[model samples]
Target chain A: MIQRSQLDLRKFVAPEFICGHGALQLAGRYARNFGMRHVLLVTDPGVRAAGWTDAVGESLTEAGISFTIFDAISVNPRSRQVMSGTEVYRAEECNGIVAVGGGSPMDCAKGIGIASSNMRDILAFEGVDRVPVPAPPLICIPTTAGSSADVSQFAIITDDVRKRKIAIISKTLVPDISLLDPEPLTTMSPELTVDTGMDALSHAIEAYVSNASSPMTDVHALEAIRLISSALPAAVREPHNLDLRFSTLLGSLHAGLAFSNASLGAVHAMAHSLGAACDLAHGRCNAMLLEHVIAANYEAAPDRYDQVGAILGAAEGGRGTPAENVAAFRRSLGVTETLAAVGVREDAIRTLARQAYADPCMVTNPRRLTCEDLERIYAYAL
Target chain B: MHMHSDPPDDRDALREKIIGLGETSLHKSYYPELQSRLAELERFRALLDQTHDAIFLIRADTGRLADVNASAVTYLGLSKEELLAMPFASLIAPHQKAAFLETVRKSNEVPSGSRRTCTAYLVSREGREIPMEITVRSVIFGDEQYIVAIARDITDRILTEEELKIKESALESSTNGILIADLTGAIMYANPGFASIFGYEQDGVFMGKNLEAFFATPSVGEEITGHLLDNHTIVKETIGLRSDGSSFHIQVSGSVVQNDAGEPLCIMLIVMDITERILTDQMKRKTYEQLGKNIEQFAIIGDHIRNPLQVIVGYVEMIDDPLAEKILEQSCRINEFVTQLDRGWVESANVRQFLRKHGDGGEPPLQTFIHIGATKEEDP
Candidate 1:
């Protein structure tokens, strides 16, 4: 490991972003500036029913940009949906894309753009730097506070044939513009709010303690942890409060920018397998798995974990470690669900362990993990 | 610890709760909006049909044509109804139909919007074979899967490409030195003939060199550029410098090449080595001039000798002595020999034939006597 003073090289990448109460209205204007004559507007049915999709469409029409709707994307978006979206994009002659939902719609949009531009199946692009071309101009208006697909360089797409979520990481997948508006966050249920908020917390903590972390990512990760710790409970309790929603949105955005450059650790790697195999909410999986990963990795980076513990309101030099403090925080949010509680079978632990061990995120984990070690961790989580 | 075993009653309660949640979450029904937003798509049909390339939509499951554009109808030489009723495989050549169907199957298996291109021959209604480039894309519309093919005739394009290849081959094999240089005199291309003429083993060694480097003087390149700028194509003989720094006579014919916009792009120069021809011409001219001078000198010498000989002959005849008569006879014979020498020299006659006609077949020959200015040593 290079000491901070001896570190000589670092690179950071982030998308052009805006965060405010009604920045979602700027999606169409940004699309026009990107030279979009016609666009494919990707969203899920839930976001469509929440009225954000219609609002985004009105903005596009007012800006004199024609668009087509592709709302067939589902949670844990399948590769088939991405291909179908690409077909619609070509049929409509869309010059750009506007995604108006959570991670599923945005990831589906990214997959569509990648497949269309590269002229290959979406599954062909898995892992880092595999996408050969930049996606068409994409403007994202994220409705959920977590899963910052609006500004992230990551696209998690599920391969229905393989029954696993493949993470495609490339700077080209970063949206051309991100329009974050807290108005849409009011529609999320309290359970969803807690789950997604905890996902953001996992993103911050894991990025801060990752082997690839640097000073540039450290600041954003810590700031995200501070904001999520302070504002997530309030936002979950009072869903309609715009201020708390904005804070959580900013926190998620910072966490995304941090992990995008610094990368994540075992928490994300393990959560991906669980999310894909069980078809569960991704944030809930990450929340359930974050504390255990930290417990396993705290010995490798004690100072960074201690800082995270302090941010979560643990006393300085306290008897409890940061991993315990984070667990306490998860309990306070009422998200203490075990793997068995979520209907995961003990027989599947070995398979999930092997998949998580092979995930790309495992490479950046602070402590090296073997397949056996991952299986043990899964048992511990159970 | 004598505790009574309690039955696991919570399993049924938990199962009921999960089933309730799953029922509420899993139920989905499609509701089509009554809005008239997607009506703009009707224009796509006309646009697709208006294209020059043939477009056909085939059902993936049946491998039959579901729809075809006007261009497809015209290209296939069949009516729209007939074309749509025919199987897509019937239009493909019999030998290529299997491969085409396999490609269509693979396209169906791949994700929608993935495309594949193939070069195949399409059989027309009259059994005429037309080479075609076909692009097939998988599409899903209204719950049905289709393979849309756009085919273009590539006969003219292939012919043009072949013609270009022939021309390029001819240029490469030409014996005359050929060079193409930019306006700034930098050599862009040099053929093998140019390399050999310039004493290089390969054309690549001469590329990017200045055109002036191959000229005996830099001013020659400038003069050629000046003529080219005036749109004057010229052929001129000039000195050429070889790679070894030896100079030789060369004939250069140069013209300016231009683009469709009428802007000059480069200068094309054809060079021919004319050193041997120039040397032969110079030798012939020198021989002719020397023969003329020799004839003029011979005439002058003959006139001077005859004038003196006549004076001597006249004086000897006046004296009327035997020896003096002999002298007069000999002088007359000498004068005859000199006159014969002048008259016998014909430009067209072979020297050996002239010798045989004039010389004796003995120790002393007639041509030898003429050279000594004596016919006989004189009966005196």
Candidate 2:
């Protein structure tokens, strides 16, 4: 018998918005406002092949902004690749940037933007808000439906020296504009669709249970959970389902807005280090590690997990024992299987446990865990 | 009357006894007073002679034959006999004699606590002029007004002041932009070079502008302000915006200026314009980029031309007898042209030597400096 009360929610809106279906169409307009004449368009080979690069280039050309295309960005962008991108940005006299594609391209773009303006080595800027300069006017056009890097104020660049992922999170690095177009995402394979959709779900669910979770973030997180759970399977089954594609795209957007403000939990912290060290997909790592991390967080804030479980159709009438709620949520997300199915090794548990404890995101974990507790969690998941 | 007269004689006797006692007291005080006074005058003379300050005594009636202490001889570079024999006015340098006489006369007229001082030239034994501070104090001695003159030489202090002025002037005219401001960032002084670096007039004074006025970007202002408040000095490179909105780069060294008591008084800004260096750097970067493009284009051309040249060489090697001679000659010309182009673009000292001394190595090396021509000396 939960009574519904009028709760005051605080919302943080962008001072200005550069949004819409083909919002990338305004790249040149925004660039001009920043007094930029030359621009850099950073994207990956896949996005270039899919014609998103041409679309963005056409927009810039229309705005009378001359630009050079850097299609050398790789997935899970390496330090060398970002350095090369920075060189390209400098060589081209680019004063503005347009990042087109998934999290990989946008992340690489953020790295190039920081390194080019600040003149800092890529390896030196990892794990926090180390970048001090405002990046050039950047427009992010996310072509993938899953990675919400378009609207999120976060970027992950690989640190080649340490062989780890360096997460650069700063309001300075946030793109001045995010151009979301569901049309490009229609061409993704079912596997990519499933993986990205699951990533969005992970974002929403993690935000819901985060220690810094607020009513404002909770609304978006719950909406994101509902949209992803309903439309992800449909998107995976039918890549061109426009309705389902819109839902997944919007879901990713909501999750981005939610998690960006509220921050994430231990899942992202551990997933990032593992993905960087092991060269695994970001979404795949999150998917494989999701259940164990949720179970661990449930002990810290059962009510919070219960709210998440209820949002995902796991909690019965939105009320249940903590274990039952989490178990039901695990079953609903189809992540109940052993971590072994996802190619994670039991032998690597100790190393992964230590890394998870050292992660930056662990600072915000509701219940702090010892190294031994981390080991037990990994073993259980394995 | 006779009886009253006898009574009056008793009164006269009492009066005589009183007079006798009074005389005895006066007699006893006189010797001690006179002896102490003589000792006091002797001690005063000895103290005046030992002191470093020159002391002079001027007679009001003649203004000549004045007495001076022993320090006056060394101070005025004069002999004791000459100082005693010379009128005080004669000892004063001709340029200062009139002013000295007027002051001495004024002090005499107002003998009670009259005092005056002036920097004047005093003549020495060899007629050399020594600058000295002459102070006159009027005093009444033996019912006559006498002037006491104390003289001090300040040549060393004056010379040090002149040196400081020269150094300060040199610093003001320096090419390095230097600025000093109060603790509140109010500009106290700006060197000519500092104003000119920002394209301002040498006399274009800035009194109250904050340090933030120099930077175009807010972040730089914030960073510099924080560093200045914390460390008292900061050396950084940033873009400086001119009043005209055009920006230039500078290397600024800022430090806290302190007062005599070591309290912070102001900030000092030393600016070095690095705009030219940044421009040169940008030009060098552009040159490198152009070079890279040119290299890529040249490589493409090399590949295109070398492929056909290889075919020609292959066909020529396949030829035999009479046609072989024509084909071989043409092949050699083509090979020579290719080598010429290679040498133009590439220079490998070791590879060229190896190629000249020995035939091509069997294995292709990982790194190749592909020369397109023969050596410069070998070329026609």
Candidate 3:
């Protein structure tokens, strides 16, 4: 029983974004509008191989702009790679950034922009609003439909030293523009498509029940939930369908707008810890831990969780509970990996629990979770 | 001004920021950086204006003024709008717009950071022209190319150079040997006269040689340097050693040149060759000695003549004949002549004393040569 009144103060921020088939091609035009002279094109090997990097490069070249391609990125962007990309940005005298990949490259591009503008190491900006100076112009062209890092004001970089992911949270991390083109989403493999689709579903669920959720965020969150629950299964079945891909892209964008404003809960906090500890995929970690976190946190915000359950429950022909419906949805999308199946051992749960307990994303959890409670949650996922 | 908060307080602040409530929390607007960058540019502009050199930013494509500094206004005696409206080349000497266009083209042909310098006269608003050394460099900011012209007034430098040339001519053609040496007695400069006197070419190895090498006694040069260091000036006659190992008299007058702080910088010595004067002095001394001996001989000869005359008078008294009387008279005459010879000797000795007192190097007395007034003994 959460009640909202018009008197309560709230704020919403979304980047200037364009959505359609040719949205990614308009990156160069938007970059020029932002006064970008030379740009650093950030992407991964997969995205570059899929021809997104070349297409964007052609667009920039046609617009009479210069760019340097830095494709040294992984599924989980490392602080080392972020700093390396920053080195390229400075060495080439690039004045702007264009990220053409999934969340890893986009998040890494955000990290690079922050580091280059602040003239410091990326790890120094680990806390919230720590960046006193904003990064240069950033344009994101997300290939996969997850992470929503293109629209979200969050950049997660793995600190290779501590073997964990550090979050740099600032409104400044929001990109200047997001080119939401679903054509690039057709090139994702079935597993990547499933994993990324699950990531979008987790974002909507966590944001809808978050303590920081507002009327504005709730509208985007519930709609995101309804869209993802209905489209994610069919999106995995027909990975090449533009309509299915566009639905997922639109759903991720809506969820990004929701969570970017409302923030996340124990699921993201625990997921960041698990992803960093196991060296696993971020989407997979979220997909594995999403149901477990929902079960543990169901008692804190029952009414909000009930609304979320109704959308997912309707998809499952009215299921048992919100947590059960989420599990069934993840399974239907063919994401059925347990924590141990992904190489997460039982002994590492306490350290993972302690780290998640301290994550900034944990601050918005509906229920305050202790280290012991998080350890039990990790155990349940295992 | 900045106090560190407690850890819990830090966490609280971070949470507030995570919820977008911190003082610095905002979306990526770039307003602050824009404000800071604009302020920095203003500071840089102020710095440019503070300099005495006139700075100009010209659009490379149009050869037109894009910007100008404060000094440019003061130099051209024109308002900012007036300067900006005119073609940049119109401000140059003779208003050669085509020439400046070519210069800009040449400057742009080189690499971005390289520059080229040329001398030009800047025609002012009052029609007065100022000589300037203009260094032009091509610069780029974003999409537009600009030419940065930094003009420095060279009037003072030109005048200084002309004055230096005149002084150098004087040193080159001087008749007196002028030598400049460091405090350590090493020769730094020697004028043409100095090189000629020392039997060395103007570009010879004598340069960088110690001043002691030119002194007959090396220690004489050292002593003079020490004296000049302590006393600041010295004028003494010393022996000089020529290249052929010959020594001659040299009159050297020297002084230490100091900077505005009154600290000694170098030694300047003016030397004159006095060997002929010394030789002439020795000859005059020898002649005076010989003249003194001749006068003494005259007195001795007078004594011998008188003695002989007296003996002849005695012989005449003994003879008692008329021949004897004649002989005695003749002897008396002779004795009187000897007395006159003695008087001549005394006069000659007085003349020698007078010559020693007033003669110029064995010449007769100045009054005797002029014959302005005869001496008391010589007057009739």
* Top-lDDT candidate index: 3
DockQ versus reference, model 1:
0.01
lDDT (Cα, tens digit) per residue for candidate 2, span A1-382: 1122335344444413333455566566655555567888999899899887898888778878899999887778998999999999999887778888988998899889989989887767766678787677677888887778877777888777777787777776767767676778887777677667777877887777766667788788889988887777667768887777888898998898888776777778777867876787787677767767777777777776776667655423435554455445445545545567666788887787777777767765666768787777767766
| TM-scores of the models, in the order given | 0.53, 0.47, 0.56
Clashing pairs in 2: B339-B372, B339-B373, B340-B372, B340-B373, B342-B371, B342-B372, B343-B372, B343-B373
RMSD of each: 26.9, 50.6, 22.0
Better of 2 and 3 by DockQ: 3
DockQ ranking, best first: 3, 1, 2
- What digit string (tens of lDDT, one per residue) describes model 3 on residues B1-380? 56666555478888967765444444455643664686699899899999999999999889889999999999999999999998789998776656766777899999887899888889999999898988999999889999999999999999999999999999878977899999998888888888777777653566789988998999999999999999999999999988878888999999999999999999999988888888877777777767655655665575567677778788789887968877878887887676666556556656766776665445433333223212222522
CAPRI grade, predicted model 1: incorrect
Off by over 4 Å in 2: A1-19, A314-338, B1-380
**How far in Å is the alpha carbon of A246 misplaced in model 3?**
0.9
What is candidate 2's CA lDDT for residue B270?
A: 87
**TM-score (chain B) of candidate 1:** 0.67
After the best TM-score superposition of candidate 2, give how far the Cα of residue A146 lies from its true spot, in angstroms.
Answer: 2.4
Local error of candidate 3 at residue A68 (angstroms): 1.1
**lDDT score for residue A290 of model 3:** 89
